[model samples]
Target: MCVAADWRRLYWWVVLQWVVGVATSGPCAQRCDCSPKLPLVDCSSQQLSAVPEGVPDATQVLNLTYNHLKTLSSRQFFSLRQLRELDLSANMLTVIEVEAFVGLQNLITLRLSRNRLKIIPVGAFSGLPNVQFLDISENEILVLLDDMFGEMPSLQKLEASENDLVFISNRAFSGLPNLLELRLERCNLTTVPSEAFSRLTGLQHLRFCRLGLTALPNNSFRQLQRLQDLHVSRCPWLHTLAVNSLIGLNLTSLTLSHCNLSAVPYAPLHHLVYLRYLDLSYNPITTVLSGLLGDLLRLQELHLVSTGLLHVESGAFRNLAFFRLLNVSDNRLVTLEESAFHAVGSLEVLRLDGNPLACDCRLLWVMRRRLRLRFAGHAPSCVSPVQVQGRMFQDFAESEVARTFTCRQARILTRKPQDVRSDEGHTVLFFCAADGDPAPSIIWLNPKRSVLTASGRIRVLPNGTLEVRYAQVQDSGYYLCIASNAAGNDSISVSLRVRGFPASSRNRSGSFFLDGWSFASGQTAVNGSQPFPFDVKTLVIAVTMGFLSFLSSVALCFIFMFFWSQSKGQIKHTATIQFVPRSSASTTAGRSTVETGRFTMKLI
Candidate 1:
């Protein structure tokens, strides 16, 4: 044994150089692509200007996307401590240094989307305490200060939508108490800071579309108490919403579409009692009043499409029980009041075509109620009466439209003769045609009964015609024409008579003749030239007492139709005569034949 084979050949050459330095230290790394059966490290779009040191310390996905990586300094992935996904998204990232995600404590997804990140400094996400998805969306970041996402206490989704984000400071997002989802869409947020979402108390989906928010103030979303889908839309200068904004929201789905909202502030949506799905579509909201969506009792689906709505009042969808789906399509609705959907008793999808719906009988309760309306078969037509204009509401016939549709009560179809005389300063029209069913309300009261108010030469027109213009003499007497609806009121008076010259005949001056002929002696005279004598025996006794009062009203209407046709034919021949009372009659007849012997004559 020559010295025991030289110490066993130097212990097999030091175990072959320590197994060749652990097999060449594995993660290859020249221009990255380390895979090793999937610990992945692609180094995407590699035009890399940094962040590429020998990766693979068991790298757990680290795609430096479209890389031109500019400054992410401090410990930039200090040898990928088993990085759990870190895609410096489309990077040209301008500064991130602070702790620059210190040694990403198991970073669970951190993208930094399309970056030129304007500002994020404060601890630059200190050590990404287990970052749970953060995007930094299309960034130029702009302003977010305070805790600037306070070092991601397990962030749960944030997008910073197309950011140039105007200002966020306060507690920036108070260390993200597990943020659920926040997008800040197209940001330049004009104002929302007061408690900037009070620390997102476990936020649950919030979007901020094209904002320049004019007002959403009061406790601005009261710390999103478990917010559930709140998408603030296009915000054209937002338009006030304060009353405790969304009080302690536990919302389900609230959109606030196109937001130039004219009105929808029912005490800040009455606290969204677990709101279900409400859009407030394209808002310029004209009218939807009655208790304004009641209290949204767990409302189901209500969009109010193209909200320039004209009227929806009647109990405005009451307490929307479990309201199904109602869009109120393209608004300016013409007529709906037959209890305007009475209270949406679980309405099953009703879009109401594109409105202008005035299909008579007030839509006959939607064609005699069976409401399962979906409107895909395109119905809601009738813009109005020209014999059912475009006729469609399910081709109507609810009892032939409730027997030829007649809501009659306000009947004043202008039959003329209510005495009108206008000549003072001329101009007089009157005319009021009414006949009703849901279309009445004419109102023109005047002769001191009040209500006639259309100023300067008086007007009223729109078909109910009144137009007085220059007629003075205090516009003479009685002028009603009321005409109400819901089947009731029906006025008609008229009698105007504004002739002329009577302010005590212009202070008794004389010579008045524009057809109201008067040569002097006056108390007011027209045509009759009164002031005394012209009596041909009282004009033959007033034309024989008006021709004996028109033949005494035609002999009292022919003696009341001949005694009402002889008392209606003696009550119909005494109910078809039927009397056979005879037994004792036979006996009495034979006895009376003589009264003890008299000649009895029987006649048939």
Candidate 2:
């Protein structure tokens, strides 16, 4: 008897609820065109060219997306006055006429994304006083008029990204005090007026990326009091963020990647105590000021990749106690000094690769000793002469990528031995030296066309020295010496010669001898015992070597010329042949002309 009574009571309650629903939905049913059996209406992805008037009466949800609609007239939606959510996304709409939603007084959510709408007239949505969520993203909106969104008194979320917006006027969003999220990414905006966004006091999330913004004005974001996440990345020309621009943001995540920023002031970001994730990757920043990034006490992840940094000064990261992951790869760093990573005790994953690290004795000491470190393996192995080439640290190291690493060598200049004085015929010496890895070998070229070695007349020093017993005037030609090592090779040539003697006999003896010994004016013949002081042996050797060099140069030049002529099919050759008066030239009195079949030769 108790179970039967309970069942009867439940049945009566259901009937009473149904009666209430019918009484309250009478007005909605009379305005809409949908069936009374269903409360929601759906016309999404139906290739609709215009607003559908076939909706059921008492409809609450209307979807007509993925269509080819070019316009939305206010009269078309005047019948759907009971709709609560309307979706018209993924259409080819380019315009919204005046008072487009004049009769949608009960509309709460509106979506019009992925359209080609270029403009939205003022007061277009003034009729929808109950609208809260509006998305017009992926449109061609070039400008936002002053009062384009002033009628959306109840709007909370607005997305207007992937557009051609160049400038956002002041008071464009002045009436949107309830807006929580606003995205205008990739809008091609070059300047942000100081008051452009001052009215959005309650906004929470903002994103602006891939726009060529260079700098921000001070106090640019002072009005946004509840902002939480701000992402501005992949802007190559951006450099500075003005002081206190993010004063009232109270943000949780900040990203500024590929911005070409070299330095940042620490005081500007001090107010962001709630920041958790910060990314400054793919920039050209070289130095981090003391206590710069350390001010972010709540930071959990920091990315500093490809920043061209060379040194990390101690205490640079002293205040990052809350950081969990740090990436410092693709930089020009050679070594990490002790205590460089001191305050990163809370770090769990560390990345340090793509850096040309010199693994010499100094770095070896660092590898063997430093304590309290928490890394996976040997800092991913310094890719010295071996490059990492777009691969990760672990991947490059796992393939035994260290075998190609080697040291670089220095370059040296070489010269040939020459006579210092023509009268005395004193022998001159030449040498070439360079500091290198694997030590370079020096080859000396002598006037005798032979490789020189260390022995009396010709000597070679460990420091790469070449000496000649007696230099002569004939030893005046090009001499080349090469020094090679692991890194590369270099060669130099010096023209060797003797000093010219004076033309007069008075410049050869007595007072001339004394002056000759003191100065170079008369310093050729000391005793006048040897005529010319010519070393025949040295001269013969030098002449022979010079002749050989000349012949070789001529042969090489001819070979190059032949190949070049064949490649281009052009021969530039012209000769002028002169003829003297012949003894028996009485036979030809006229213009003397000698010609062959296809050759014309004239004598003048």
Candidate 3:
């Protein structure tokens, strides 16, 4: 009896421990939140297939990210009324039925990024009135219908970047009137319509980076009064900006990078008086005008790199007084003007490298005078030739301090009379030359310039001379030649004439060979047209034919002699055998015959 009681007690204790161990192991069912402490429910990275049920009603934060959940039905998440932060990022969610989040009224932070959602049905967030932060980035969202976010009244931050959004319809974002930060960066937004963001009155940050935007409407960003930061970077095709396109925006940091702008427009950037950071790098801007940087009073950092800027107009940058970090590297500038760095009194850490600098007296003066105080030790070195084609720029030492280094324009080789028209088969002779530092190319004006050449008859001589043996009537108009060097172009034209057949017929000879008549003045006419006569060619052909005929006769005579000698003995033997055969046949039949050796018939 004692042993049985002890065993019962031990068994009860073991059973209680097993029950407690399973209760604290994990979530009790699907979509259940079993965070370690503080009513925090984290079901992320569990590879959950279904929306887990049995989540604690007191759950404050629910994390369902990094899962393979396909769809979010309306009733799946209805129990989590107390949930505030919901993370469903990095999932395989393809479709979200309308009103999926209709009951989550207390949700504030909602993340659905990096999913496979192609389209967002209307009223997907209809019940989430208190939602402030919403991220739907990195989805296949190509189009946004109007009033898409109409239900989220309190939504402040919206990140819709890195999707395939080609265009946004007007009033698509109008429902989010209280939104503060709107990010459309890295989306395939090619064109932003003028009224796309018309109703977002409270917007402060608008980011559009790595987008395929080519052109923005004239007043696309004009209405955003409270916009502070406008990020437009890594857009290679945004080559032009209309005046006042960005006028009204109170931007603090503006980035316009890797664009091919060659000149700063006359547009007004002064409207953005609170601007702090401005980046305009990797462009083709070659010149800087006066008062260009004067408008950015509160600017801090300015980057102008690889801008193809070779010239700085006098006192171009003498007005930017408040800039801090100035980066002007990777340009084609040969010299820095005296007052270029005299401006920007608060500037610090200026970088100038990878530029084609002319390190002459003018450059040395800038180094000695203002460089130690402004540029420090980050000045670039010269990249051009000290001695080009055997001439040294340093040899002109006297003019070094005042010499101006200007970029010589490339002289283009062009075909003169560029617009050429003629009847087919018209021959033309073209000439090409140049009138600049480098030679130019001259050529014919076809789809591509092609030279007129004929084998053995047409020849291009070593000295650029073209010669033709006989000009045909088809070869009547123009021929082209292309000559070029590094400079610009000049072209010449040569007119060609080809004799045509007329109504009356004549011969090639001076005297009409066909009619056996000699005309006066040594005139030669063919088909009623007078052409140049060549007697030497005719004489040469006639002499060659006579010599060939004589050789042919001698060959025939030698062939006859060789055959006559081979047949002489055969002829004699054939005659002797003819007589012997007849005599032998008669003797066999008992008839005799005699053969005579000689007979004299000349006596008669």
Candidate 4:
């Protein structure tokens, strides 16, 4: 009877343990929330140290965001084989054991962003065969090793932005054959090797913004044949682009703004014929040379804002037949040549504000052509000629332009004296004033007819004043002031005479003059003598006087010929003759006698 009672008590204890196990494993655990209707689990922000265990096996979506989960063991999701989406974002996950996602064969999307993961071990995602989207952004990932995602062949999009990724192996993305978009913004990568994207032929979009890269090799994207959009912005030190950097890709839109480039790399850009949108803003490119963008036949929009551009060559947009939008604002352009926009006849939107534009006749073509340009309410202002400054280009009148913006010929407005006197070792200035349509260039020719350049003691002021500091006896000769422009050229002459010493005593240097009329002693002067110089100013004056005298003589000759011809035509003719007749007496004696007297005529 005692043995029977012991067997009975042991049997009852075993039955009670089975009942507790069955109750705890039904659809939910102590901290996790489960829904049997939709087969979903929500264990987020639970402050749990590990994944709750009693989640339903039929759960297709798992939400574990904002949790204190520290590790992902290999059997963490072993029961959720039908899990299609998993969210572990904003967690303290530091380690993911191998085969951590082995049973989730139907998983399509995984979010591990804002985690403490520094490395992804091989085969970490080996079981998720159909995973299409993976986001590991804002993590501490240091490097991307080869075959890191080799198990997920169906992965279409991957975002690993804002990480500490400094190196990516050549075959890091080798198995991702269907990836369409990859974003690696704000990474610590210094360079993207030539074979970094070797086999991503189906990739349609790629971005590498704010990376620590300095250059891009020619073959960086040689294997991305179907790439449509590429963004490489905010890379402050990225300046170099090889000749064939974008040769093989069929890109439709490319952005390289704020990369600190000094010039537009036209050689590599010429290969992208199918490009439609291009942005090269916030660079230091100075000039847009002709044919630089002529090969992009189908190009539609171009952005060159704040690029420090000063000039645009005439044929810069020759081949952009379908171009619709052009932005060249915030540049240093003063004027666009007459043919600068000749090629973009189909342009619809044009942004030209924030520039120091000279609104003269050169820009009248835009108004006359009646281009349907959409300025977006911000018009460019003129910055030249004082009268037209601060005026808009569209406000210029066509009828008044010829009278107001006429190309005037350069002429001398102020002339220096025929002869100037200066003491030895003194300063002398010769003045010349000129006026023209386009500002004329002022040049000074010395007595030797050689062009004078600014030197130690010789300087040309902005207003065409030649200042000779410490003038010596050898500087005593005719200096010419020549002002020239596209319209014409004018010149004036001034003879400089150093008074105080003869030619032989010039080198003695006893007492010299410091000012034009004062004398000083014991002062050192430039000790040299110029050769016997040719006075071009004197020759010019002589030729001009001769020409005027010849003109005067020709006028006199013409006046004399005119008067002689008038005198010949104005001769008056007068006939003074008296006619005497003696026929009356013959009438009375008709039969007797008839006499006629001879008449004498005097002409005066």
Query: Model 1, 294: alpha-carbon shift in Å?
Result: 35
Task: Report the lDDT tens digits of candidate 4 across residue range 128-192.
Answer: 88788899999999988889999999888899999999888888887899888899999898888
Candidate 3 residue lDDT tens string, 286-339: 787877666667877777887887777666655566766767787877656555
Give candidate 2's whole-model lDDT. 0.67
Candidate 2 similarity to native, TM-score: 0.55
Task: Residues 195-258, candidate 1: write the lDDT tens digits.
Answer: 7678888888888788888888777777678988989999887887988878878888999999
Best by lDDT: 4
Worst 10 residues of 1 by lDDT: 525-534
Candidate 3: where are CA atoms >4 Å away? Answer: 1-33, 268-271, 341-344, 358-604
Off-target runs (Cα >4 Å) in candidate 1 are 1-37, 40-75, 78-95, 98-118, 121-134, 137-158, 161-188, 191-212, 215-258, 263-284, 287-308, 311-350, 353-412, 423-433, 438-455, 461-604
Candidate order (lDDT): 4, 1, 2, 3
TM accuracy, model 4: 0.62
> Which candidate wins on TM-score?
4
Score every model by TM-score. Answer: 0.34, 0.55, 0.56, 0.62
Worst 10 residues of 3 by lDDT: 571-580
Displacement of residue 291 (Cα, Å) in model 4 is 2.2
